[model samples]
Target: MTGIRAALARRWPTIVIFMLLGPVLFMLFDMAFEQMSQDPGLTLARLGNWIAEDVFFVPRFVFMLGALPAAVVGALVAWRDSRGLASGRWIGGLSAGFGIVIGIFFARNLFIFTPPPLGAQLAIGARAFVSVVLAGFLCYGLSRPFARPLLSQEER
Candidate 1:
């Protein structure tokens, strides 16, 4: 469709960045999974013991390595969209962060078998949601200084 093509044309840089980074992100996740699978029993034992302390590491890594870079790329795209005057940085960052988190959830579901118990699953889901939201907010805060209102263009 023309509409889709137009949108892609307008946002090609962001799309290209995502496309380039996606495989690397997936590979990192696969490596993490492979490491866990290699010693499932020991990993499980360690996880059980450290659930309260380190259970958030994976989500944090996803936010930092996966979402943050994507958000920065998106912010750059937004800056370009604003004709180099305003960034719209928070909007881009939040959208990218949320998108990455959703993608991660979907990928986990698709690739991972042997589901954990319901309670554990629920806890993990909740943690991921919270972590993503927090990361989004952090990105928003970090971006605010760079972003300007689009309406300012007309005012100038």
Candidate 2:
């Protein structure tokens, strides 16, 4: 238990960043899934209508009002986490964060008969993997200027 505590003590910031950024990352992921699928439109429309319907869109008001603000905040969080190499908290936080989302969707289905299609499940899973790559590149790009110089193998 103390081992877990000690690890958490050292990694809390990483974990918290993941917790904060995971959902926004997932939302950003919707665009990728749509690009890959037959219906090449924002999947956010399908999910976000429950929140707000007439906020903003390229052609129409598809994305909800909160989306702009959410995007801004998400960007900030991503930038905040954009230092150093990926940490163990990245994996742990992704699993834990998505677990909560899955739990919420599961509970929602208990009350409502409608369930999201299998594509949505595939998207969620794919997003988990894709997010790592996307976030890693973002971190790499953001940290490049501040990163220390690398050396040849002999230097190590």
Worst 10 residues of 2 by lDDT: 57-66
- For 1-156, candidate 1 gives per-residue lDDT tens digits of 565455445555554444345433443333344345455633645544543465446534543565555545554554455454444454556545665565457445633468767665554454444444444444444444434443654497
Residue 113, model 2, lDDT: 50
Which segments of candidate 2 are over 4 A away from where they belong? 1-26, 41-113, 117-120, 149-156
- After aligning candidate 2 to the native by TM-score, how far in Å is the CA of 41 from where it should be? 4.8
Q: Which candidate is the best by TM-score?
A: 1
**TM-score of every candidate relative to the true structure:** 0.38, 0.33
Q: Which lDDT value does model 2 have at 107?
A: 34
* Off by more than 4 A, model 1: 1-69, 80-113, 149-156
TM for candidate 2 is 0.33
For lDDT, the strongest prediction is: 1
* RMSD in Å for all candidates: 10.3, 10.2
- What is the C-alpha local distance difference test score of each model? 0.48, 0.43
